[model samples]
Target chain A: MPKQERAEETRRRILEAAQETFASQGYQATSVAEICQRAGVTKGAFFYHFPTKHALFLALLEDWLSQLDQYLNPDRYLGNNVAQSLYAMADLLKAGLTQGRDYLPMFLEFWLQAARDPVVWQATIEPYRRYRAFFANLYLQGMNEGSLCTADPSLAAVAMVSLALGLLLQGLMDHESVNWEEAAPAAFRWVLSLMAPDPATTP
Target chain B: MPKQERAEETRRRILEAAQETFASQGYQATSVAEICQRAGVTKGAFFYHFPTKHALFLALLEDWLSQLDQYLNPDRYLGNNVAQSLYAMADLLKAGLTQGRDYLPMFLEFWLQAARDPVVWQATIEPYRRYRAFFANLYLQGMNEGSLCTADPSLAAVAMVSLALGLLLQGLMDHESVNWEEAAPAAFRWVLSLMAPDPATTP
Candidate 1:
């Protein structure tokens, strides 16, 4: 492999190892040495790729957030009927948010890091706010298109995201409480019905 | 304080101090010495009350779960109407789940501990299952009483609890997203309406 290509590959391997270690052992317990060992790379390689362990973790966070954003394509499949779009969005979330072995701790670790560290927290909050607005805009688009019931879209978005997070957490912390995939469809239906424009008011 | 009262007060103090330290510094970072320092008790006194830091954490977890049970008393103020009972429960949860300085870390720490340790995980899981049944029973009562719309109470209860948990997590992570107290009442209304029995079907 070319020198540049080989370097990039090494960096990717280190990141994957770090993500896994951090997810399994948690942010506090996982270390650069361990991540380097797992990646089959030396400490020098780890330092060459990332300045600090926190920087590498930030890289992991960005990648995960990007993956999450890709799944929530409101513009692509949501369409003008906001209520239907909302239901569709929930279905998409249910499919996307399966609690894989490595995902939950990594995700929760982000929250824990954000809680304690100002720099990390500031970086974390922007994407979170963007996520909230993304949902809000979907609701607003539905209302403007005359497909949704006239209620507070922002507030509804808040409720929607809150409910999704809660479900994800239950799946994470306690796996057997509910079949998230089955329940997601039912939940989406309920929320959509709440947002749908009244037949009496519709032309 | 009397001799017995003084000892009880010291135990409470140690538990509270441990909880605060663990929540803020995390489980791995915190030490029994720090807890003793915070509690204004000696190491001997700390050891006298609890054998180990892990044991104290377990005790704290027990208290947290029991406190939740007390908080979710459906029969506290509201009577036999299942809808009233549920709303009351939801309202209590909203009012009680404060993150402030001490709670958020402690909450996340428990989760992290549960993830890493099987013993801790098993200890925490039992009460969590009880929450599911507690909610399911409320819905079953509501349905049988004819005050609620007829539906499968078990699934509905699971959904409702999921929503509540999701909201609680959001509140813990992002306090500014929604005025939870106001939103909580609306959530209760939404669930009750969705599950309420049709008047025509009532016996």
Candidate 2:
């Protein structure tokens, strides 16, 4: 590999190792030395790629947000009915979660860190606003197409996002008790029922 | 003051100081020494009430949960219709949160600690299960009484709880952007609409 390509590979390895370490042992308990050891890189090399542990965490946050953005891209579901598109989005999240069960703990760690640290707070809040805006636009589109009920698009957006977050948190806490795969779609349908126009009241 | 009265006061002082210190400085960074100083007590007095910092955290968790229990006591809403009961519950939570805005950060800290620490996790999960069961029974009652739509009560319970959790999280993340007091009841109505029978469809 060329020198730049080798550096990129080293950075990727460090991030992977950081995710694993943070997931298993958590952020506060995990140390730089351990992360370097897991990445199979020397301390100097790890420093070269990321200035601090906090910076590494920020990078991970950015990576997760971008992946979510791609998953929820409106362009990919352009032809489907609004309800179908929403279900597809739910299914996509469920599938992504099943594949990345290890990521749950790390994600919680990010939330906890963001709650306490101002720098992390700024990094998290901007992406969160963007997500809210993305869903609001989607809700407006669904209403304009006449497939969904007329409601405040912003509040509808908040409801959808909240349901998703709640399910994720509950799954993390009680995976043994609930079948999240089945529950996700069921919950999505319940929310969609609220967003559907009333047939009986239609003139 | 009597010795017994003096002792109780000291314990309360320690807890109040711990709540303040943890809220401002966070769990990992705050120490027993600081808690003792803020409480205006010596180290001996601090350890006399609580054996360890972890024990103090557990006490705080218990305190918050008990307060929630008091707020959510179903007896408070007896004779109200199911929709009314549900809205009352949402109002109760919103009121509790509005009063305890200072506790939000500490609550997140508790969750993070529970995720990482085995002792905390064991303590947290049992109470969480109890809350879920409590909501599940409420949904069953609402459905059986004909005030709610005939759907799977357990799923309804999950949706309600998830919405509340998500709102609490959003409130924590962006309190300036959202009026949680108004949003809570509005979101509750949205979820309740899903559980309510359609007047137009009913004969």
Candidate 3:
């Protein structure tokens, strides 16, 4: 492989190694030396790609947010009726939950870091605001299409995100007690029912 | 004061000091030395009351949970209709948010610790399960009282708790962005509306 290709490959390996190490040993316990050993990369290579462990964590956050944005792209579900689009988004989230189960602890660690560290907080809030706005826009579009009830889109958006966040936290804390796969969809449907226009007047 | 009373006073002082320290500095960073300094107690005295930092944290958790239980005691709002009971609980929660604003970080730290530590996890899950069961029982009672809609009470309980948990997380992350004081109650009202019996046919 050429130099540029090899550099990209090394970066990928470091990230995968970091994720594995963080998942198993946790963020506080995992060390750069261990990550380098796992990645089979030199310490110089690790430092070249990321200045610090926290920087690497921020990169992971960015990657996760981008992936979420792709999954929740309103454009992908826009052509469908508003209710259908909302359900599609719900389905996507459920899939993400199942796929990301192994990484949940890492995500919690990210949240904890965001709560404690100013640098992480700054990195987190922007994407969080974007997601909130994205959901609000979806609510507004649903209302405009007359498929959803007339409610303040911003408040509706907050409610939607809150339910999602709450379910994720509960699932993390009590994975065995609740069937999140089933519970998540049910909760989403309940929210949708609240948002849906009254059926009696539809005919 | 009597000897036993003086001992209780010292324990209370240590807990208060610990809460303050954890709120300001977070769990991992705060040390027993700092806690003792804040409490104005000797290290020996601190050890006398709690065996370890983790034990002290567990004590804090127990205290918070009991306080929450007292605040959310169903009997306080009993004899009123189910919808009224729920709204009352929401009011209580909102009051809690306002009163506990300064302690939110401490609560988040506790949650993070629970996620990472097995001892903390055991302490957390039991109280969590109790709260879930408590909410589920409330739902069952509402249905029996003919004030709530017909639905699976367990699922409804989960949904309610998820919304509350979501709101709390959001409040911690973006306190300035959202008026949790208002948003919390509004969300609760929306959930209550969903659970309430159909007014059109109530006569």
Candidate 4:
């Protein structure tokens, strides 16, 4: 392979190895030496691509947020009715989580790290607030377009985020207990039901 | 102090010291030596009451759950209507969290530990499942008692747990983003309103 192509390959390998180790052993326990060994690259090659382990962590964090940026981009979902749009987003998250169940532990790792490190806390929390805004904005848009009923859009967004967080946390802790696969879609439907303009459906 | 009373006092002091240190430094970072120093007790005294650091943690865990056992107790709320009962429960949790906001970090510690260790995982998850059952049972009772509308009680319970978990998790991380004090009661009331027999309120 060419020098440029080989460099890209090495970078990808390092990132992939870091992801696996961090998820299994947690970030604090994981070391550059271990990541290098798993990636089958020399320590010098690792340092060349990523100067430090912390630098590698930030890159991984950025990659996560970029993948999630789609949730904020509503251009595709905007055309659909709000309820439909929400179901689509729910389905997307559910599918991603189902495929990456082991990766769920990695989230607990970040959450614990953010709890301790101020800098990491800020980096992790900034995107979280953006997601909150994204959901709140969608609720407002839904209300404006006559697809939803009256309610505090921000509060509604809190409920949505809480539902997702709570379900994911419980699911991570006890695999068999939280049926998030069924619960996530059901929850959205229930929340949408409450938001229906007509209240005649409550029996 | 009497011998029995002095021993009880020592245990309580040790527990308090452990809670504070664990909250500030986290479980892995905290040491038995540090806990003894904070409690102003010798390691010999500490071991006399609790054989190991792990044993001290288990005592704390048990203490935590016994306090929460009231949420599962229906006799206190059994006299009131279903909506009233739900509000009381929400208030109970909200009040506890508000007062113990600092202690919230300890929760993250346990959650991280449970994710890593199977033994700790079982101890943590068993009570969680019981809480799930308690919520689901109340939902079912409400429907039968003519206070709640039709819905899957188990699913509703999942929503409740998720909302609480999600809100608390966010509040612990960002501190500013989640208004759980207001949101928790509002979310519960909203859920109850959906369960109300009247359908004229949504508009």
Candidate 5:
């Protein structure tokens, strides 16, 4: 491989190592040395890619958010109708979360960091707001399409994000507390249906 | 003061100081020495009341959960009727979260700890499940009172909690992210209304 491609490969290995260690032990507990050892790369290589552990975490956050944006790209999911589309989004969230269960600890780590570190919070919130706005836009489109209820788009958007977060927390924190595979989407569908356009008005 | 009363008072002071420190600096960053100094109690006294910092945290969690239980005592808040009662709960949640905003960081800490520590997670999820069951019972009552619409009570209960968690997180992580003061309750009301009994069947 070319130099740039090899460099990129090294960066990816470092990130994967960091994520696996962080997920197993936690962000605070996982040392940079551990990440280097796991990645089979030198500390120099790791520092060259990420000046600090936090910078590496930020990179992970960016990568996760980009994947999320792609996964939730509205174009990729539109059901037979607007209401179904909303339900589809909920299922997509469940599928995504369930698939990412191995990294659940890392996700919680992000929340803890965001709550404590202003820099991490900034990185976390910017993406959160973008997703909120993205959902708000989708709800607005549903309203304009005249197939969704006329609830405040911003309010609905906030609810959608909030519900997703709540489900993720429950699923991660309380394994076997509930059959979330059933309960979460059920909760999502119930909330979505409340905001679903009146069936009487659907064209 | 009586011996027991003095002990209780010391405990309260330690908890208060711990909350203050944890909120401002976070759980991991806040040291036991700081908690002792802030509480104005000797380390001996601190150790007597709580064996470890983690124990102190669990005490705080227990105290917070008890307060929540008292605050959400259904009898304390029954609107003119059942449907209104559900909405009242939403408003109550908003009021509670807003009042507790000063300690939002600590709340997030609990979640992170729960995700990492099976013991903490066990403590957190037990109360969570109790609250979920409590809300589920209320929804089921609404249905039985012949006022609520026909819907699965469990799903509504799950949505209610999940939405609140999501809203609290947003309000905490992204200060001034949105007018959550308005958006949260509105979102809550929207979700509650969906589970409200059909007006046509009201006795």
Candidate 6:
């Protein structure tokens, strides 16, 4: 690999290592030294790549959100109607989760930070807003196309998103507590049933 | 006041104080000294009431579970049909939330503690089981009365419970970000609609 590519790869590795350490030890209890040791990089290298521990933490948050957005992108699931799109979104999340146990801890860490840290809250608020807006838009499309009910679409969208987050939280907190893969499909179907057009008026 | 009633009041105050301190400072960061200070009780009185910090936390958990149970009690909402009972349960929670902001932080603190601490998890699990059982019973009643669709009632019940918790978390975390009181009733009605009897076949 070229020198620049190698340096970029090292930066990614360091960020991943920092994420793992913070997930295990928590952000407050975790240290720059510990992250450097885990990454197998010198403190000088760590400092060159990231100026502060919080900066490294924020970098990890960005990476995680980017991956999440990629998972939930409309293009990936829009081939079918919006109902199928909803199902595919749930399926995509369950697939990632089954492969990414470490990701759950990072998610929990982000929530804890958002609850307590102003800087982290400011950084996360825009992404969070975008997520809610994206769901609202999907609901609006479904309603406009007559695929969904004419009820308040924004509220329906928020309810579905909240349910998904709650399920994800239950799974994360107790890894063995719920069979989320099975549950996820059911949740998607239930949400779809809400959006599905009424059949009573048909001839 | 009677001696027993006075003692109970003191215990309640101490638990409330400990809950607030734990929510603000976290369980590990909160010391017995701090709890006692917040409660305006001496260390001697604190120990007399509860032998240890863990014990105090457990007591707080028990109090919360009982309060939740009373709020969602079938007896309170049982006079009417199953559909009305379900709406009543939702309304009850809405009212409690409006009046219980001070306690909401403590409940979230309990969730964080359960996630990270084994002792707290043990204290929380039984009540969690009770809540699931209560909802399962509610769903069974709805099904038997033909008020709800003929699906797997238990799973539907679980989803409803998950939705409630998820909605509650969003409301708590965002703090009026969604205007949950208005949103909650709408969501509850949507859930009810999904459970509604199929009109085409019902008649």
Residue ranges of candidate 6 with Cα displaced over 4 Å: A1-10, A96-100, A124-128, A175-178, A197-203, B1-10, B96-100, B103-105, B197-203
Stretch of 10 with least lDDT, candidate 2 chain A: A194-203
Residue-level lDDT of model 6, residues A97-182, one tens digit each, is 57556676566566666667878866665565577778888888877775666467777776777677666665555555557678
Give the Å shift of residue A34 in candidate 4: 3.5
What is the lDDT, from 0 to 100, of the residue B45 in candidate 2? 92
Candidate closer to the true structure by DockQ (higher is better), 1 or 6? 1
Candidate whose lDDT is highest: 5
Per-residue CA lDDT of candidate 4, range A31-146, in tens? 89999999999999999989989889878877777866765466655445775566556665465557446656666666677777787788888986887788888888788888
Kindly give the stretch of ten consecutive residues in candidate 4 chain A with the minimal lDDT sum: A194-203
Chain A TM-score of each candidate structure, as shown:
0.89, 0.89, 0.89, 0.86, 0.88, 0.88
For model 2 the local lDDT of residue A115 reads 72
Per-residue lDDT tens digits for candidate 4, residues B1-203, read 89999999999999999988977766766799999999999999999999988788778877877877855576776545775677666665466557556656666667677777777788788887887788888888888888776568888777777777777667666767677677766665665565663232444
- By TM-score, the better pick of 1 and 2 is 2
What is the DockQ of the complex in model 3? 0.54
Is candidate 2 or 4 superior in TM-score? 2
Using TM-score, give the best candidate's number. Answer: 5
Alpha-carbon lDDT, every model? 0.72, 0.77, 0.78, 0.74, 0.80, 0.71
The DockQ scores of all candidates, in the order shown, are: 0.47, 0.51, 0.54, 0.58, 0.62, 0.40
lDDT of 6 by residue, B104-136 (tens): 556656655676678887676556555657777
Pairs of colliding residues, candidate 5 = A148-A197, A149-A197, B148-B197, B149-B197
TM-score of chain A of 6: 0.88
Candidate 1 lDDT tens digits, A75-99: 7665446665565665665665563
Candidate 4 clash total?
0
Q: What is the lDDT of candidate 5?
A: 0.80
TM-score of each: 0.87, 0.89, 0.89, 0.87, 0.90, 0.85
CAPRI grade of model 2:
medium
Across B115-203, the per-residue lDDT of candidate 2 in tens digits comes to: 67988877766765677788889878887787777468778777777777777777667777667778766776777777774333356
Candidate 3 TM-score over all chains jointly: 0.89
Tens-digit per-residue lDDT, B1-203, candidate 1: 79899889999999988887776767887888899999999998888889988899999988878777776776685755776566555566566555333577777777777888887888766775777788778777776787676446666665666677766666666667567667755654564556763222346
